[model samples]
Target: MTTRFDPRKALLALSAPVLAILVAVIVTSLILVVAGDPVGEVWSTILSVPRPRVVVSIINASIVYYISAVAVAIGFRMNLFNIGVDGQYRIAAFAAAVVAGEGWLPGPLNILLGLLVAMLAGGIWAGIAGLLKVYRGVSEVISTIMLNAIATILVAFLLRKVAFRTEGSNIISTTPLPEDSRVPGMAIIPDVSREVYGLLFLAVVVGFFYWFILGKTRFGFDLRATGRSETAAVASGVKVKRMVLMSMVLSGVVAGLVGMPLLFGQDHAYGSTFQPGLGFAGIAIALLGRNHPIGIIFAALLWGFLEQQSNALQITAGVSDRLVLIIQGVIVLSVVIAYEVIRRANVRFEQRKVAQALEEQESMTKEGAPA
Candidate 1:
């Protein structure tokens, strides 16, 4: 059947971003005005990361951030919040780093071993929450939060007792992986200090797999159905508990990679100074993207840009770093409101169209009088 054109629906879809941007701009500008800062100038500074080096840095950062966001998105698709992704990845990376440091075989083999270890660690960690939810009726959120704290303490103890190594630079870290196992960066632009991360290819592969699984696979359908309504999905013959377990494991698998881009490509070791809070940032990005792979990429990029712009904001506009936080919060709130309004409008439009079709059919029936 041919579908009717939905002008209101189309307009609402486009207006969401527009409205969000307008709100964010107004709010941020007002904040700047109150602080006696030139609003236009501050905005200009935020947008000044168009330079080649800055752009490369943003891209590099986005690679890791995109993986982190995708990990979060997987859980969101199943209506589960895997909040312990930070703990999962950190512990996984540490364990992977220790394994990679033990040069047992050749370059490729060692790297493969490290990746496998990371995935195993993350999956085991997340599986605990899944198991608890299925068997004990515990909430995943509460269990995952507790698991994060446990993971942090466990890693700290391991680093001190088992995996610790003193580098020449006086930085205590997990033993470094061999150079041969490290992913080499691509110097895409000449005379630039930054090199595009070798793990960018890994991110692309992950994005493709995420799209394929969600858009094409049967498990994807069941996962989505469960998310929509667990009781209905269970009645439909879907094993909801099994789906939950599998989804959490899969989410953890992706979360395992969140640290690899930095671990294999940049740091080559897990240290006390390794970047944290990526999993939390992933939560925000996944929400912003609404759990689509392509959407997550753009969301991650925007988030990375904002993070990268913080330096420029401080240097050029003399603004506090907290301003970025304010803008981000406003944008997220605005988008959520816009989407809700659009959802209600679309529902009303669909109802009206159905009623009109029914009325037209009744009128046609009445005109065919048999008198």
Candidate 2:
């Protein structure tokens, strides 16, 4: 069955996030004023045009964020919350770093090998939770959380005991990938010394696949069906357990790519200093984006922009960089509240329309029948 496009519905859907953002801005401004900060200066600093370097940084950061959000969104679509994305990506990255550091294969092949290993590591790590949920009836939330802690400990052990350290570096890290295996950054932003990530195209591809897989395919239909109602899905011949496992694994596979941009284009190795907490951040982005691929892109860009501007806020407006955190927290909360309010409003409108239609039908029936 084809669903016709409804512009009003689309507008209504978009309103929640927009309203939430405006509320966040207002709240943040009030907070600044109350804290004796220069609210106007803070606003100006955040809203001003960024330098080319900062733009590049924001774009790069958004790429990573977009990928992470996509990973989280996959599980969200399946009614699964794979919170261990942090661990999945970290383990996968360490595995990739270990492989790339070896340079056993020729240039391009080495890069491909590392990527494959990363996906495998991530899938296997997340699959454990899937297995537990399917066979042992363990809550994925609990299992994944436990897995995250274990993954951290395991990675730490492997880094110290198994992975070779880069020579002369104080930071404990895997051997850096060979020059040939490293992806060179693209000079997409002219006049900016900072180059965009070489793997920017990868994010595009991931987004396209995410949209297609979830919106187009039979598997996608079954996944959504199961998400909506497991009992009904089972009655319709969907394999709920298998879907759960596959969805979790797929999410982890994408999660594995979350670190690749940094690993290949910038960091070139997994290290103690590798960025953490992106998995948690991705959850917020996914929520903000409403699990839609296009919405996720905007949400990620907004998140990255705010993060990039936080430094400027601290330096120029003399506000603490932590102000951004408060703003972000408020935005997330506001989105939740806004969406709930909009949902209730929609329900009421629909109910009223149905009642009016029923009343008109009754009046017309009486006039035609007894008169």
Candidate 3:
């Protein structure tokens, strides 16, 4: 069935993010003024055209961020806050590292096997929280928070005690994967020393699948229904509990890929230097993107650009790199407030339309009756 589009509704939908961004800019500028910093210089530094290498770095970073955000967005869509995405990706990357380090299979097969192991590890870790929520009536937020700590400790222990230590290195790390197993980097940009991660394609594929599953399939419909109202979904014959479990697992499966771009394309091993907190960052990006696949890509790129600018801000503008963090926080808060305001406005508009329709119906009936 073709759905009729409302231009006014579309305009309202577009306005929220734009309003949020404008508010963030104003707030950030005010903070800069209060701090006695050169607001214009900071803004100029942030908006300055980056070098080719920096551009490549931004793209590579955005790829990882996009994948991570997509993972979080999946859980968000189901109204499930999978806070343990950070932990899931960490543990999964560690497992993938160990498997790839083994080099038990031939080149391509070994890489594929490691990827599969990562997905399984992530799914299992996230499934624990899902199980508790479904069967034990536990709050997923609390359970996942605890799971994050547990996963951190577990990964540390495994790294310290079980992982093969690289000789003469100060940092502890799993055995590095064989050269053949490492994914090749793509020279997508000219005159750039750094190459884009080959796994950029993976992010594209994940986005495509996320959009297709959530927008075009029966399972997606049921999942969304369950998210909106479990009782209503149950009345509609959707198995809410099963959807809960599946959604969490599916979210984690994507989470497992959070580190692949870094792992396969650069690090080639999980180590002390492996970046943390990406899963948490994904939450912010997911919110900024409104949990839409396409929106998440732009949000991730914006995040990546800000991150890349942090260094330049420090060197050129002499501004604290932490300013980026403040900006990010402000943007998220603004977006949340804007969306809430828009939601209330939409509700009032609908109510007014309904009231008007009812009044007109009553007037028509009275006119038809004998005076």
lDDT of candidate 2 over 17-111, digit per residue (tens) = 99999999999998888889998999898888888999999999999999999999999999999999999999999999988898999888998
Candidate 2, pairs of clashing residues: none
Weakest 10 consecutive residues of candidate 3 by summed lDDT: 161-170
Query: Cα RMSD to native, each candidate?
Result: 2.3, 1.6, 1.7
Candidate 1 global CA lDDT score: 0.85
| Runs in model 2 lying further than 4 Å from the true structure | 1-3, 163-168, 363-371
Question: Which candidate, 2 or 3, would have the higher lDDT against the true structure?
Answer: 2
Sorted by lDDT, highest first, which candidate order results? 2, 3, 1
Task: Go through the candidates in order and give each one's C-alpha lDDT.
Answer: 0.85, 0.93, 0.91
Q: For model 3, how many clashes?
A: 0
Question: Per-residue lDDT for 256 in model 2?
Answer: 93
So what's the TM-score on candidate 1? Answer: 0.93
Candidate 3, which segments miss by more than 4 Å at Cα? 164-168, 361-371
Error of 2 at 127 (Å): 0.9
Q: Give, for candidate 2, the lowest lDDT window spanning 10 residues.
A: 161-170
lDDT of 3 by residue, 58-157 (tens): 9998999898898898888899999989999999999999989889998889989998999999999999999999999898889988999999999999
TM-score of each: 0.93, 0.95, 0.95
Query: Candidate 1: misplaced stretches above 4 Å?
Result: 1-11, 163-170
